[model samples]
Target: MALQHGVTHLVLSAFGCGAYRNPPQHVAQLFKQVLMQEYDGKFSQVIFAIYNDANAMRRGDGGNVEPFEKEFGIKASVFKEQ
Candidate 1:
């Protein structure tokens, strides 16, 4: 639907992973699979903006970017706390 409407970029949040208690790693993998396999080359860019809150920072949630970088062979630019 989005692609059909000429949407070139996508920003995704962690769905079902916070209050819904879904596994973060599994959700990430599913997104990777769909994007790389099903919608490969369809989007100009895709971004996953994982919120960096107190709990996420404490849990090293930034590590979630690793698998996506590894799978896509792209380096991620992380914004650090100032």
Candidate 2:
């Protein structure tokens, strides 16, 4: 309902790529398809919030964040302060 309510940005995730063992590639593709086909240009920005945990990424070749980065063509980097 974000669209109906005039939402501009979105933060998505790799749904089902966790303990459910859903393939990240497939999940990422579906997310891309729906957003591009249905919601393209509807929002100012779309962000995929994939926690870059090494253990969580161990399931697939690139892990949870990799597929999303590839699918969306952007690398999500966490900021750290020294």
Candidate 3:
């Protein structure tokens, strides 16, 4: 249905949640399966935005962007802490 409707550009966000920590590998794999494999060339770009609330089940968390970039063969706009 997405392909039929000509849907392009997918956004995968908020992956830094409690679902990880126990097993983090699954998070990245799921993103690839849903966004990259499903859409393939249908979308010009796919943005993986990772953000988590401080008071959530998991706190003091930072997301890994490089692995996602390499896995998807894309570059992301990220900044480093001072």
Candidate 4:
């Protein structure tokens, strides 16, 4: 849907959601998978603003930001500023 419309950027603004409320970590992966499948190769760039949600960011111990680049094959950058 979004991809079909040529959405270059996708934000998982799952704000005020259940999974975002609690998780064992995999929950976040599911979300990412869904997004990727929906917009795979459709967008030139995809950014995931998981905020401090370790699970959403796939952080095993703390948080791993590298997976975004390795798995998705897309350049992942974490931005924090005004």
TM-score to true structure, per model: 0.68, 0.82, 0.51, 0.45
Candidate 4 similarity to native, TM-score: 0.45
lDDT of each: 0.70, 0.80, 0.57, 0.52
lDDT by residue (tens digit), candidate 4, 2-79: 756877776653342233444424444665687667646776755556454535445344344444345456565668
Q: Report the Cα lDDT for residue 54, model 1.
A: 47
- Candidate 2 vs candidate 3: the TM-score winner is 2
Question: Which candidate number maximizes TM-score?
Answer: 2
lDDT of 3 by residue, 1-82 (tens): 6567776766766465445543234566777786656666777776777543333324333335545556667677765445
Q: Which residue pairs collide in model 3, if any?
A: none
Once superposed on the true structure, which residue ranges of model 1 sit more than 4 Å away at CA? 54-75, 79-82
Clashing residue pair totals per candidate (backbone < 3 A): 0, 0, 0, 0
lDDT of 2 by residue, 12-76 (tens): 88887876778888899999999999988999998887654555567648778778888889877
Model 4 stretches astray by more than 4 angstroms: 13-20, 53-82
What order do you get sorting by TM-score, best first? Answer: 2, 1, 3, 4
**lDDT leader:** 2
